[model samples]
Structures are given as C-alpha cells and as structure tokens.
Target: MSRFLFVVPPLAGHVNAAGAVARALLARGHDVAWVGPESALRRLLGDGVTVYPTGMRPYGGQRDRGARALRSLWEGFVLPFARFTRPAVARAVAAYRPDVVAVDQHALAGALVATAAGLPWASLAPQSMELTEPLRALPRVDAWIRANLAAMWCEAGLPAEEYVDPRFSPHLVLGFTTPALTGPAPFPPHYALVGPALDHDRPDEPDFPWAALDPRRRLVLVTMGTLAEDVARDFYPRLVAALAPLGDRVQAVIAAAPHTVPDPPPHVLVVPRAPVLELLPRVGAVICHAGLNTVCEALAYGIPLVMAPIKHDQPVTAAQVVAAGAGVRVRFGRSRPAELRAALTEVLDSPPYRAAAARVAESFAAAGGAAAAAIHLERLATS
Candidate 1:
C-alpha cells in the first residue's frame, strides 16, 4: 500500500473534497495523511485521520465590486497564502516523506514543494475554474498570473521554466465537476474530470424541521455560501421579501450568518446553517451565490438554480450553469426583490431547467466521484 499525503488550504469546501478522496484511499487499504491546518482538517475529516499541521493564514477579505476583484484575489489572498505556507509545507514534506502528495489547487506551495522534492503529486481542483477560459479571454491578466507563479517558484529555488500553471499538476489533475455542468473545454490528457467528491457518510446532520415543511408547497433553498455571509447581509432581507409573495405556494429556506435576519417573513425559514445535502432532495430549486460546491451539490440532486454571482470564480461558474440551460444568473449587488423572485419563479416553474439539471446529474454520476479520484491518485503513486 502506498502512502499518500494530502496538502490542502483551510477552506471548508477544499478540505471536504480532499477528505472524500482520502476516505476512498483508506478504504482501498492505502495509508493516507494530511498536511494542512490541524484543527480544520480534524473537524472535516474526523479524528481518526493523521495530520501534519502547517498552520497558515486564512484567506483575507476582498472587495466584492469593480475590476480590482481579481487583483485583490492575488494580492490579498493567493500570493500571500502561497508565500506563507511554502516553508510550512516544505517542513511537513521532510518530516512525513510520503510516496505521493495530493495538492489542493489553491495551495500552490504544496505542489511547488512536492515538485522540488521530486515526488509525484496530483492537483485537486474543487472548483472547475481551471477547466474554463476565464484567464485565456484576458491575456494580460493571464500573463500577470503566470509571472507571479514563476517568481514564486524561483524564490523557492525550483525551476521557474517548469511552471505552466501551478493549479494543473504535471502528473494528474482531478477536477470535481463534469463537462455537462462546465460544458466542453480543451483540457490536457493528465486532467481527469472526476465529479464532486461528496461524502455520503457524514454524521453531522442539522436539526432541520423537516416535518414542519409543507409538502404541498414547493421548497427552495437560498444560500450565499460560507464566505459571503457579511457581503450578503443586506441582500438576504430582499430575497426573503421577494419570495414572501408566494406565501403558502412556495416555502424558502435561507442559510445566513447567525442573527443576520432576526424576523424573517412567515414563508421564509432563516437558519445559521442547513444540511444542504439532506435538504436538496426535497427542494425543487436553489438560489445560491454560484459557489462551485453548492452548485454541484444542487445539480447532483437534479435541482435547478437561480445564481447570483458576487466575485471570484462565481461568475464563471454561473455562466456555465446558464449555458447548460440549468439556471438563471443575476447581479448580486444590484438585483432587486422583483428580479430575484422572477428568476426563482423561472427556475421552479420551468420544466426545461429541471431537465437540464437532471442531465448534469447523470454526467456527475458517470464521472465516478471519489472512487475515480482515488483510482487516478493510485495510478500516480504506483506508476
């Protein structure tokens, strides 16, 4: 059995995706370990797993508006994160000496260190951003990103010429979405489109009042994802008000920050968190921030969406959803209650949206999920 080390960022979504693959590897009789923030990994993967803590700073906040968003992503989070984690990851590698490393896409330092050490590594892309042409469309931005990555590699004493995109592994790249959701894209032979690695055995089921939900009314889930709680505060009330008109005909479940909305309308259920996987099966449509994980989860259950993209890869993911005929997109900051209600109504009332979502669901199932990801990692380790 080969020993595998997973290097991930502190982000919950990235950790969850990597954890799914780690569980699959362990089930296959391979020894697995993690190199990341210890507390966060323990919370996501449970206490049984071994972890080498490389505590790094959390991703800082970014401005939600203007052309500066991408700049802020690099300056505020990406570059700083890599710089901070590089030494820690290098230390972890020396101490653990695993056969192969599974590197989260955002954690570029892991890949750089592993490559420098001549160990096989795979890139875990929780989001499908690398598969899309967002950067290619903007050549200058793409060049700027590449330059920064090259500089980072050079500073770490690794060959800068070897760097193409740190997010794409030289050995393997595991994308967590299928072409059905992302549409067709030209990817390299090493890239594998393994669908979202959703953990089916997670024990933390939220105490949702499932019995209280009316079966007669169509259910809808509204969430701005984990990172957007502060940015989406003002938007939540508008969303609640918009969906309130449906009253008994439609029931809305809004997941926001704790105490963000004290008194929601009668038709809306405001909670700090919702067991989204458990709730998706009963819901007809989802209104979300177009986060890759949330979008994939909703689509996995064949539920259509109303996407409001705030920043980062959200706009790209939302575009894919709209292009696939599975959802509608709206501006997050400017969208009014009337617009949100109209978009939600379209997703819920239209049969085509449901059909498209079902089609994506089939593709996701075919992509083989955590099992497929494990197989690829195993191949990398043994090859």
Candidate 2:
C-alpha cells in the first residue's frame, strides 16, 4: 500500500469531497493523510486521518458574483493563501514523503511543492469554475488568469518555460461532477469526471432531529453551505416565510444556525448544521446556494433543487442545474419571498424536475465516484 497525502484548501466544500476519496484510499489498505488548516481539518475530518498543520486566514471582504467574484478570489485569497502556505507545504512534503500527492486546484502551494520535489500528484478539482471554462467568452480576463498562473509558477523558482498548468495535473484530474449536469463541456481524456464523491460516513456531522422529519409531507432542505454565512443570516428569514405557507403539504429542513431562523414555524425544522448527506435521500427538493458539493450531493440523491447562487462557482453550477432541467435558479439576495416560494414549489411539485434529477443521479452512479477516483490515484501513484 502506498502513502497518499491530500493537500487540500481550508474551505469546507473542497475538503469534504477530497475526504471522500481519501477514505476510499484508506478502505483499500492504503495510508491516507491531509495537509491543510489544522483546526478546520480536525473539525471536518476528525481523528481518523493524520493532519499536517498550516496557517489559515478567513476570506474577508465582500463575496461578489460573476467576473468580480472570480477575479477577487484569485487576487485577494488564492494567491496570498498560496504564498502563505508554501513553506508549510514544503515541510509537509519533506516529512510525509508520500508516493502520490492529491492537490486541490485552489491549493497552489501543494502543486508547487510536489512539482519541486519531483513527486507524483493528481488534481483535485472540486469546483466547476475552470472545468466549465466560464471565462472563455472574456478573452482578456482569461489571459489575465493564465498570466497569474505563469507568474505563480515562476515564483515557485521553477523554470518558467517548463511550467505545467498546476490546476490540472498531467497524470490525472478528478472532477467532482459529471457531463450530465455540465451539458456539452469538453474535458481532456486524462480528466476523470467521477461524479460526487459522497462520503456516507463523514465524521463531525451536526446532530439532526430525525423524529421531526414528517414522512407524510414532502421534505425540502434549505442550506447556504459553509461559506455563505454572511448572506445566509438575512436570507434565512425570507426562506422561513417562503416555506411557511407550504406547511400543509411540505415540511422543510432549514440548515442554519438556530439563531438565524430562531422563530421558524412549527412545520419547519431549523438546525445550526445538518448531516446533509444522510438527509438528502429523505428530501423531495433542495434549496441551496449552489455550492458544488451540496448541488452534486442533492442530485446524487435524485433531489431536485431551487438554487440561489451566492458567489464563486455557484452561479455556474446553478446554471448547469437549470440547463439540465433538474432545478430552478432564483437570484440570491435579489429574490423576494414570493419568488423563493414559486421556485421552491416548482421544484417540489413538478414531476419533470424529479425525473431529471433521477436521470442525473443515474449518470452520476455510472461515472464512478470515490472508488473510481481511488483507482485512478492508485494507478498514478504506481504507474
């Protein structure tokens, strides 16, 4: 069995998907470990895996949408965080000496360190931002991104001419999505679209009141994922109002801090956090911020969505959901209660939406999830 180290970002959404594959590696009698923010990994992964510590700074400032969000992420967070974590990543690589390094796309330091050390590595692309090429229409912006990547490559003291795109490893790239939802987007032959790496046994999932879920009424899940906390506070109230009227036929599980939706109606169950993976099968539809992990997880369970994208790749994922006929897209913040109500009702009551979700789920299962990803990684490690 080979030693595999996962170099992940501090972000919950990215880490969660990688965790699934890491566990898969473990299940096959391989050694699996993580290198990221110590506290966050501990919180998300528990004591099952070894974690190498790294510094983390909360991503401050406004989480804008579209081009602004994309640009701001690279400039404000990704580059700076990469620079900050570079030394620590190098140290982790030196000490662990793994056969293969699985690097998250946003965690540039991992790619840099692994490349510098001449170690085998694979790309862990949990987001659709680059895979779908949302910025292709804007040539200058895309060029600017390329320039930044090239500059970062040089900064790692690697010869500029020999630089490979760190976001995509030449050996393998594990995409946490499928063409069923992404439409006609083309990917390279080396890119493995392994659908959602659903970790059914993830640690540290928040407690939920299972008894409160009414089997008679259709269940809907409302969540903004981990990063959308700033907007979720205000958004929760609107969600409460929108779903309240549907109580007779629908019971909703709103995954928010109790204080965010303190006075939810009797029919609504509001929790600070939820074991969403376990809850998806029981849900008829999902209302979410379109975080890739949540979106893929819902679709994997054949649950339609009412997506209100907040920032980053969410808008793209939400667009894909709509194009796939599996969900409705309502504007985040700009959407009023009535709009939310209609979107939610549409996904819940529409037979076509459920059928589309089930079809996507079929595609996901065929795409091979954690098991396929682990096989690819194992091959890359010993090839």
| Model 1 lDDT per residue over 141-214, tens place | 67888889888889888776666567778899899998897777887899898888988665444677777788
Which parts of model 1 are misplaced by more than 4 Å?
Answer: 203-205
**Model 2 per-residue lDDT tens digits across residues 104-141:** 99898888989999998999989877777747765766
Each prediction's RMSD over C-alphas, in Å, is: 1.7, 1.6
Could you tell me which residue pairs clash in candidate 1? Answer: none
To one decimal, what is the Cα RMSD in angstroms of model 2 from the true structure? 1.6
TM-score against truth, every candidate: 0.95, 0.96
